[model samples]
Structure formats: structure tokens, C-alpha cells
Target: LFGKKYIVGGNFEYETELGNIKDGKVLKLQGLSQKHRIETTKMENMLSYNIFASLNLTEDFSLLGSYTSTKSKEYDSDSLTIGGKYKFNSVGDVVNTYFDNLSGNKNDRWRGTVNILLEAEDDSDRTYFDMDGNPYPGDYAASTLYVPKLTMSLNDLKSKWSYYFEGYYKDNEMFQGLKTNEAEQHATRVHLEARWNDTFSRGRYGINIAYRNETSEKPQNYGKKGFREVKRGVHQIRLTPNFIYNLGNGFALNGSFTNIYEYNYIGDKEGQGDFIMENQGGIDYSGLMPRAFMRLNLFREDTWHDHNNATERKRLTQIRPTFRYFFGNGAYTQLEARFPIYNGGYSNETRTQIIKSENYETRYGIKYIQPLAPGLTGTIGVTLLTIKAKNKATG
Candidate 1:
């Protein structure tokens, strides 16, 4: 970020991990009961840091802030975040709070954020194959954990279409960081979008839709004493749609779809629900192959689940291909599933099992995207986090 009034950004990360592991030949005081295999050599390390800032003095007011920290052996954390954009409403602290200008455009309409967290714990990182649980591994007792989070954003930008609404909350969240279920969350989201691009003989298209809802708690943090981490209770819903098109001389077309639903409860056990669907379709090309481009995709997924009266189903399909080329500073490279391994060609890789988030089975792959300076770059991994939260909640 450069600066209009003010802007700042920062990041630092360090990580290391080394191979070979499989040690489970137990039977003593330093371990529990494993009864088998062994092979070793492992190493790990991690470190993280981040910093952020933003501010705009007039035209209704704006401000933001951030801080983050992490160390690992599972985790050790710290976080702090602040938010702003104001016209009316008053608050204390942060320099006595002042943001006069009462709506002269309210920075295009509201934005807010708040986050706080602190975590620390170490119980020798147990897990050596149960057997009377904690048969060994340090001594322990509860210690440290405090979490808080909130986010709110609402917007509607002039013409050409747009929509936004967002809300989220947390107080004891740790799902996806799962160290034995942990939860407490609330979420609300809405998005809408529209576009009619230009420049290829003046033709292109766009569409977007989104919805989300959530609530939760189960085995959530702050649970201990014989792992007394609560027991299920949740409700969730999600819906998404996306699209793109540019039938111009260079050709393009795209699609997307998703659905999710869930309900879970537990008392004496037995109560669950789930249904999910994932879809995709794509086509792209760059006539004449100069900077080169070609993309093709087709993917599908299905799922269903219900508790002890049982019902479960799962399905999947796939085919994704890409061959990209570009160079001259903003480097680029791509080749995926370009087949051939032990002779035969053609592949989309599949190992049959699916819960999704990919794990190449025979899916050939190659990637190279360089330009690591001048705004720095070198990254890949796209679209997820609920479809980028509807592309940043309608921009």
C-alpha cells in the first residue's frame, strides 16, 4: 500500500519440517502401549508475524489496525485487531474517540472489526496410542486461553450492481485448528454481484450470489477434566453461485455452485445431519497462443449423512487441466495432469476416497510463478474460504 492519508503492511514467516516418522514401538515409562513399527527422523519449527494499518483522515473518517504472532509445537498465539470508519456514534478510548463529519458519504458505508486472542498450553503434546490415556508425557493442568472476535460490514456501492452484509462472532473457536473439537461461533453473510465487462468487442459477463448462516458449540475450548469438552449442538447453512463469461476472440466461460446444510445435536447421542454439493465448469483459451493460455475444468461432488439410524452417501467426479505460459518479468507457468507416468497418458487422478480438498493420486502437476519482488509474488492456492466469502462480500 502506498498512501492516500496512510497505509502500512507487514509479514514475516519461517517454517521448517523434515521427513521420516513412524515411531510406535511402545511398552514402558516414556510411552504407553503401541506394540509395533518404528522408523524415525523428524524435525519441525515455525514462526509467524504480521502487522497492518490503515487510516484516512477526512470524508467521514477511517482507521484500522492489526497485530499477530505465533510460535509452534502445535501453537502459542497472540492477536489484536482494531477497526473503523465512522460518522456518528461515539466510543471511548483510542485517543478519546472523535470522528465528526456525520455522514458526508460515510466512507461508502460502514466497516468494522475487532479481534483478541491469547493461547498457550503444553501437556507434552500427548498421543502415543491411548492405553489408559496419558500414560506418560509431562505433567499437566489447565492454563491460558482467551478468545474474542467480531466483524461487521455493510455496503452497497453506486450503479453497476453490488451488495454486501456480513457478521461473525466468536468466543471459543477452534474448528479447523481442531485439537479435539472446540466451538462457539455465530455468522451471517449475504452477497450479490453483477457485471458486464468490456474490451473484447465489448462483451463479457458476471454474476454472483451468496448466503450463509451459522451457530455452534461442542467440545469447545475451555473444556477439560476428562476431556469434558461439551458435546454437539450446531446449525449451519451455506449457498453460493458464481459465473463469468467473455465470449470474445480469446474465449472464456466459467461457472460455480455450492450448497451446504447441517444440523447436529447430542444428549444421549444420536442426532446429526449433513448435505453438501460442489460443482464447477469452465473453459478458457487465448486465441493464437502468444502469452499462451488454456484451461478446462469439470468437477462435481455430492454428500449426505444422518445419524445412527444411518444414511450416508458420497460421490465425486473430476477433470481439470491447464497449460499456461507467460514470462517477461511477471513470470507464470502451469501444467496440470499433463499425464504420463510409467508410459500411459491421460489422467485426472483419483484414489476413490473423497471428503474433498484434493490429494493428488495420479494427477500430474507442475507450477511455477515467479516475480518475488516489486510487490512480491509467488503464490498459488485459490478460491476457498467459502468461495472467498463471495469475493470479499461484493467488493
Candidate 2:
């Protein structure tokens, strides 16, 4: 019963930028506007506090609680966290529960100040207030979030394999209006992860799985009249397994796989299911100077709106290989190439007059770096690309 303290901190930031930026890589429509290029100013202020206390109830039990608050213009929130652990001395097992309540504001905007020039109206006679006489919304789009989690983990590392499991539930409510623009969401998640390594192989591997179910209700535009409430539900599951191996001699291989499955339903309609899988692999030859690196990536996805209909599947495979050489003069040269293949089609049950399509692409590039002066450097590069396409029935 000796630890109790309170800490306070805050900060302020301001930024200004002038002139517009032009880059060809960016689309014209998404480029910055010319009018606002004159000057733009941003200001932010934040304040926070931390309060913690611990009490020993008995020789076998203890209590801990903490409160934290953060206030800012762009992001604002406050949270209360309290957790405790109970130990079963006879069985050497422990159970823990942690609870948190976080509430905050979102999307703060100032919307007043529009000049309306009416006929024969002077500056003093014109109305200068915002359209609704209010600079911001009444509620400021405030939201409350709650998450309670339970975790069971092994504290002792006597075994080569260790594992932990965590489960949590979340509820978030945002008040827009009572029925017009209000929003509420609820979700539950379970996560499990494990890791194992062998000293003989000098390799390590890990696996993780997560499952979540979420439902949300929010306001939406109903036709041309106004806003109405809508409900949506989602179910998602993901699994990931990865590992790395060292074959020695400055060579190593690493690979991982992730699979995601999701089902979405809206109102009373039949839900649709989506499945996607990604695989990534890489090989590094640090055995050589200026080293050689190569990577392969594969992605596939399948979507089924209804059980009676055929599913659509798409696949893509990519390979990237590069070689680089470094000079003692602070210069380097690199050669790179990319090969990718794309294939898409409908299931046989759903196939009609259309045929599946396949596309192949190959690219090659060479780049060189040289020291032009004491403090100046230059780069030269060239790239070439080719593409080909065909269909099931086409030669």
C-alpha cells in the first residue's frame, strides 16, 4: 500500500503551409486546389492525466485501478481501466479480467461564416452568421466505447512451447440523433496464438487465429426524403501461420500464409460470403556483398452471393527479383525484374457463354548510381515492360 500518484501533461502544436505541390504520379482530380494554395493553417491542443492506485486487500488478494484522459482537437478520449488477478495456489493457476471504458468526440468541424450578398445590402446590413446559427453540431458526434477482456496465459517459460488465449467484447454507441443519425455497434472477438522453436534446427514458427462477429446499426439516407436507420451484420475469421528457417552460409527462407473469410448481411437479405487467401515468401542471399534478394507473392479470392449461384474466383501470382552491387565510392547499381500472372473465372456451374481470361506481364529494369561531386550524387535507370492476354476459347 505504498504506490499512489497523479501525473499531468499537455501540449500545443501549430502548422502552416504555402503554395501547391505538383506531382505527375498523382491524378489530376485528386491534386491540391489552387485557391487554398495561398496559405493554410492548423492548430491543435492536447491535455492528459494519469491516476493510479494499488491496495492490498489481504495476503492472497490485491486491487488495482487506473484512469487516463486525453483531450485534443482532432482526437479526444478518456478511459478507465481496472483489472485484477486471482490465483489458485493449490493448482498453480491464475485467472485475470480487465475492463475499460473509453469515450470520445469525433469529426469536429467549424461550419459558420458565409457571406451572403443580397440585393442592395451593405456589409453592415448583411447576415454574417453560419447557416444554422451554430458553428458546430449539437452533439459533436460523441461516442462511447467499452471493451472487457479475459486472458489466460502461462507465465512460466520452462517449456519450449508457450501459448496464450484472449477473448474480448466491444460495444460502441454514437449519438447523432435519437432515430435519425444515431449509431450503435457491438462485436466479440477471440484470439489465440502460440510459438515454438527448436534449438537443433535454429528455426522458429508461430501461429495465430482470430474470429469476430459484429453488428452495427446506423442512420442512412432513405430515398430522397431523409435519414433512416439501417442495420448490418458481419462475421469474420482469420488464420495466419508463419515460420523462418536458416540454412546457414548466409542463406535463409521465410514464408507465411493468411486466410480470411467473411460473411455480410444487410437487413433481411440473404448474406454473401467472401474468402481470400494470401501467401508470401522470400529468399535472401546475404552470402554475397551488395546481396541478392528475391520474393514471391500469391493471392486468391472467392466470392459467393448465394449458395444456388456459382462462385467467382480470382488468382494472382507475382515474382520480384533484384541484384545490387555497392562500390566503395558511395555508389551502387541494381538490376530488377518483375513477373506477374492474373487469372479470373466463374465456377463451371455458373459459366455461360463467357470464357475465363488470363493475363501475363513481365518487366525488366536496370539502375545505376554515381557520385558526380563531393556532396552531389546522380541516378540513372531504365525499365521495359510487356503484357499478353488470352481467353479459354482464344488461341
Candidate 3:
């Protein structure tokens, strides 16, 4: 057995803007005046990095990993992951009393298994042109992804079934000024489930199914009449069903449902004539969405004559309530609002963007949490966002 653990964190953000541009549009110079201004300044910077790792090889095995890197002068991103697990018996050494076993069947009937996993990721970028202040290059891009996974659990063919499976593959590349594009993609998934119990009204039930597929190859742009190609495809299907009910004073109720489907391939002799895959003629689009959620809970406990009169019972309290609803059709909506002020000791967040134009956009924010001692904690927040666009016709 071997073990290792480490963590480090970092973050920095800065943004500044002062503006005026009358026929080169990108404006939001807040209530502009001062004779229609003509002087501008803008600056931005961001950086981040994170890494984590873990390993334990006995008492039911274990292994885990993570990585992240990011930078900005323009843009860069990275990611990675690894996994492991194993154990066939030892069954958590049979617990000491939770309503006295309540049927988890004591110990050792197949308690662990899941042995291989591999992951990968890549992101690419290049774009520059700041002129007189330096930096120049125009356009370039890249993308990559790979995944491998496997799992096992059938508990020696026992009657209350379970199963799982997953698969993935993806590749992509692009170049702007001389036109170059490459693409490859693949995916697979499988899952099976079963459960049944009823000793006079203690119930549980389940059912699930899933499938997916995707394909792509379309990118090319090296203007002045030369190079243009585009091609794409996608397909998907999914279904799920579930239920649980155990109300003996510590209430319980649950439910589930999901469905999806999509397919598309668009034109210029079906080789995406670049300028973002010009479909100016042939088109295919489809959409469907459904979601629902509900929750409720309450509990409290104290017994055994208050622990034989040594009297100490004050820990077991819970409360949960939730609700959600949704509907769709190429839909859109947004709203925003924010305001903030706090006394000294470094705290500032000023944000504002209220229901601005074209379709509907709104945003709102206000947050403050401060306690500089006794476990030290400090935070301040203010946000405002607005976006709305829909109007097109230029020939």
C-alpha cells in the first residue's frame, strides 16, 4: 500500500475599459456623453492551475487523480484524469446497528469491483493582433479527447440484478488561413438495473435504457475564393424509470423520467463551405426536452430512556423541500440586477445590468460573508448581466 496527497490553489482577475468607437461598433460606454467621446482603453488578464492525486491499495483498493492548467494572454486550457478500484470481500466488517441490519444481509455476498479507467484531454488556440502595442498573428485552433473505462458487478448471479458500461473517442483539428480540417468521433454506453422488496409494504423499483452516436468532419476557411468544406452527423436516445417509498415516520418518495433525440447535416454540397459551415439552403434541426424534480424530508430522534437517564439527546434534525418546472421551443429569457456596499477591510463588488432589449435578458446579484478570525473567512460579491439579440435581415 502507498499513499500521497497534495493541493495548491491560485486565481487572479482584472478588467478595465474606457471607450468610444462610432463605426467600429462594440459599445456599452454607460450613458455616453462628453461630446460623443473618442478615446478608449481596455485590459484583461487571467491565470489558474490545480492538481490532485491519491492512491491506497488495500482494504478494498483505491486510486484517483486530477489535473488542470489555464492561461491567458489570449487563451490556453488543459485537463486530465485517472481512476482505479478493487475488492471482492471483507464486506465492511458487518456494522453495529442501524435499525439492527434492516436487511443489507450482514456481510460478504460480493461487495466490490471496478478495475480499469483511462482519460485524456487537449485544447488549442492562437489569435493575436494588437498592433502598435505589439502582438500579431490572426487565427489557429485545436481539440482532442480520449476515454477508456470498464466496470463489473453481477454479484455471482444473484436474483437482484445490476450492470454498467461506457466508451468514448474523439479527435479534431483546424487551421484558418490555408484551410485544413480533420475529424473522428465515437461513443458507446450501456446500463441495466433491477430491485424488488416487499415484506408487507416496504417498496423499491427500477428500470433504465440508453444509447448514443455522433460523427463529424467539416472545417475550411482560407478566403478570397479558395477552400471550403463541411460535414456533420449526430444521433441520441435515452429513457429512465425509478421509484421508492418508505414512510415509517422518516418519510420518503422519489421519481424520474428523461428523453432525447437529434439529427442534422447541412449544406453547400454537404462539405460545409466555410464561413462557419454555410447552410444557406439545405437544413435540418430537431429538439425535445423534459425535466421534473420534487423532494421533502423531516426527521428527529432520541430514545432508550434518554440513554439510561445519563440524559443527552440533541442531534438528528432534517428539513428539505424543493420544486421545479420547465417548458421549451427555441426559447429564451434573461434578467439581471445588482448593488453592493460594505465598510472597509477590502470588500467591493459593483454590478448592474437590467432587463436590456431584444428578447429578454436580466441579471441580479448581492453577497457578503465576513468573519476575519475564529477560522477566518471573507467574501464579497456583486453581479449584473444582460443579453438579448434577435433581429436579422441584410442582403
TM-score for every candidate vs. truth?
0.23, 0.46, 0.24
State the TM-score for model 2: 0.46
Name the candidate, 1 or 3, with the larger lDDT value. Answer: 1
Local distance difference test, per candidate? 0.48, 0.51, 0.40
lDDT of 1 by residue, 1-395 (tens): 33558777777766655332223333232233544333122224667777887677654466777777767665455666666655422222222333434433224332222322222222223233234442233222222233333333333333434444444444433333433433333222232323222224433344444444444333322223333334444455655656667778887887777777766654333367777878877888889677988888777676666555455455556677788888867888877652212212111213432222322223566768777877556655321111100111112
Error of 3 at 354 (Å): 65
Model 1 regions more than 4 Å off: 1-99, 102-106, 109-153, 156-234, 237-247, 259-261, 266-270, 278-301, 309-311, 314-395
**Backbone collision tally, model 3:** 11
- Order the candidates by lDDT, highest first: 2, 1, 3
Q: Any runs in candidate 2 off by more than 4 Å, and if so which?
A: 1-142, 155-161, 172-183, 192-202, 209-212, 220-237, 263-271, 288-310, 314-395
Query: Evaluated with TM-score, which candidate comes out highest?
Result: 2
lDDT of 3 by residue, 1-395 (tens): 32533323333333332232221233343354422222222223445565655576565567766777766555566777688766555334333435436875545454546656666656545433232333332222445555565655535334454444444443442122222443333333433333332233755655555454444444443333333444555444444555565554434554433333333333322321111110011111111223333343332221111222232212222232333323242222222232111210111111221112222334464444454555444445555545434322210
Highest lDDT, which number? 2
Cα displacement (Å) at residue 144, model 3: 4.8
Which residue pairs does candidate 2 place in steric collision? none
